[model samples]
Target: MPRARPPPPPPRRMEAPPLPGFSEEQFRAACRELDQPAPAAGGPWQLLVESMGVRIYRLYDEQSGLYEYKIFGGLADCPPKLCADVYMDLDFRKQWDQYVKELHEKIYDGEKVIYWEVKYPFPLSNRDYVYIRECREMDVDGRKIWVVLAQSVSVPQCPEKPGIVRVKNYKQSLAIESDGKTGSKVYMYYFDNPGGMIPSWLVNWAAKSGVPTFLKDMQKACCNYSKNT
Candidate 1:
């Protein structure tokens, strides 16, 4: 009998492509922030709202003259893995996030980048952002933690558009883990300065109302995620 080919060398296992600009240090820093206690009241951090099992707070940055927000909450019916999946699902985002006028991913200089254009109320121009983001899961003190972090980056190919305002300064960090039962606990830090002269009132409204609305929408989306996918 012809020599039987040794079982074809075990098929090579494929590995996930590395994130182009991923930084372990940055991811760890975000995790640390998530572990910190909530900012004290009567200080720079002002409580915005506490309802529906969520708390939102904002702090002013003198350098940027903008507000940065910190939010934490529990999702009663959503698991950590499901929450992360729903958040990262760009295709599904378009179907659910009404404010997403345009969103997509592209490659530039061998790095994957995300571009998002958000709708502003009438009379105000739309805003767009180009940023790089990454996510990872880890075990901390026997508890599983999931983190997603993002920051705006300058990309030569993606320049300012005529009508849309470009958000030059943006950063976001999100951490999710078990709620000790059947749900997930969440934490987030976010800031962005939409270029141009936007009224302070409008900005405040967007922040205060937008955050809770987004969480509610996300929860609803999570409920439908399995069926939709």
Candidate 2:
């Protein structure tokens, strides 16, 4: 008989935080990027659209052939808590998040580390990310808001898995604000070098079709959480 595998060890804390405030800085930068005007001189970013109240933007990185994208979630009926819970509940998230092929959480270096695999079209390699995430509540402009941020972290304990292309660098920020009733303001940013021979058409599709679909799905799930949970 084969030997049974032992349980994984518990997470450990670092003597000092690494890349302190990296996520916050990234989040701030994302906020600024969102307000900036679209380039007129024909730089990388050349696409913008608004559909179903969601403003979508895309940027093509000549250095990497990868595009950085952002989606502004217009006010939905989802409460801040419910909207935030859509992604926090990893177990339930996989069921509704159509883009995620696999996702699970593990503690590493005293932080919530997530293992995520994103589905890709056939003939293209799937993308994976190991990121440290944190959720915090803060007062923003005299109103309470919840901010959840995650960014790829390089750690020896979390190595790139086989059969998945690891995203060397990626940053995501989600800010949720409630109006004390049942309305929320949501914002998201995603940038990654998927590290594969992904064509321009696929990249375009991701910004044009993929982002809005994902956000709409999340909104629908949030609206249904009360019934399910």
Candidate 3:
């Protein structure tokens, strides 16, 4: 009798979602808009919040250009793609290796959208708040206008390590396209103080200290150089 063939080796797994900010639909849409085919559809495409050890509810909104993702309640490691200066869909393990390396050297360069996870211990009797700032250039009538920006506190409802400590007194602002008459809109995401459990400290202190401010200045300097040269 002839030997039976093996069962096709169970199809290969798909890639994980881009990042927390990118949902299935939004990612799909963005890929489609760029004339790129969507990543394969399968069981492994979803992200496993190692801390929570569960899959998150991912939602998408093409109209406002946003993707809403919900997780448990703790600090989740930064998604490799989101934390990278460049964006590419690659193996999580591979991307994570680079993430840790860049983080250690404090030379991680982020692309268009910067997603950072800042942590500080709770019960801050003597400490400063963590802030997130975006370096952006304003354009008016197709011409570069002014370089204006600001920094604000951001509170992330991390999933995984819950009940111990959470981000409180969160104040985050996003630059939104406002009606031409109203100039531009700056939206805010704020919350009350958080529970004091973890010490008011940081996980990557050297990496973030004054980095955002430095980046903002760097952008302005580049624009000035371009104009002169």
Candidate 4:
């Protein structure tokens, strides 16, 4: 597990404007994009992982350090609601979200600011992200869906700590649609530029390896969630 820094003086969640003024439209736009599914085939995306009932894709270039990933899969014995609950349980997240070393949050002004640091393997500087998380559910053509959105944010109350690189452009979302049975379909998106320099090989493997592992870990946690609770 990582470390959790002390809570700061109460500050609004995403309202403190990390860059400039962030509007509600931008937030809704992100949600819409994540909810839209990627085309069945043909695109810049390269299939990386196709095991454990999950498929992960990546789009990147040798010259560009920025990386983007689209991960989709079905949990053999997990429901969408259980999966969403586990993902939202910030406390349990630190346990199953292997890369996370520290997780904390400050709530104010009707917004939630999540502060977390992720450990990168040796020689790579540990990366951190401060994202605003929002969850919404709606009925689409009579079927219900749940979406959770998170994007990197900067707040005066939460300053960059020493010894870690801040992921200033991290944006991610998790979308799940229940099938009215015991199963659900999930779509996850991630894009970010880890500050400073990192090897392209490291980036490739993180998408191919890191993401698949995280998905399986999430499913396992869901299986025994009741026991733990």
Candidate 1 similarity to native, TM-score: 0.87
Question: lDDT tens string, model 3, 1-229?
Answer: 9999878887786643332232334222222221211223453223322222212322344553333332212112322112221112122323332222111111122213222333333433222233333333334445322221223233332232433333323333222222233232212122223434323234123122322332333223333332433
Off by over 4 Å in 3: 20-135, 141-229
Residues 84-144 of candidate 4 have per-residue lDDT tens digits of 8888888888877778899988764456788888999998889988888877775555656
Candidate closest to the true structure, highest TM-score: 1
- How many pairs of residues in model 2 come into backbone collision? 0
Q: Who is ahead in lDDT, 2 or 3? A: 2
RMSD of 3: 17.7
2 against 4, candidate with superior TM-score: 4
- Prediction RMSDs, each to the true structure: 11.1, 8.8, 17.7, 10.6
**Per-residue accuracy of model 1 over 58-151 as CA lDDT, tens digit each:** 8989998888999988787899999999999999999999999999999886888999999998899999999999889967777788899888
Query: Which ten-residue region of model 4 has the weakest summed lDDT?
Result: 18-27
Per-model CA lDDT versus the true structure = 0.86, 0.73, 0.28, 0.75
Candidate 1 wrongly placed segments (more than 4 Å): 1-22, 41-43
lDDT tens per residue, model 2, 139-170: 54566666778888776677888888998888
Q: TM-score of the candidate numbered 4?
A: 0.80
The CA lDDT at 219 in model 1 is 90
Off by over 4 Å in 4: 1-40, 61-65, 108-110
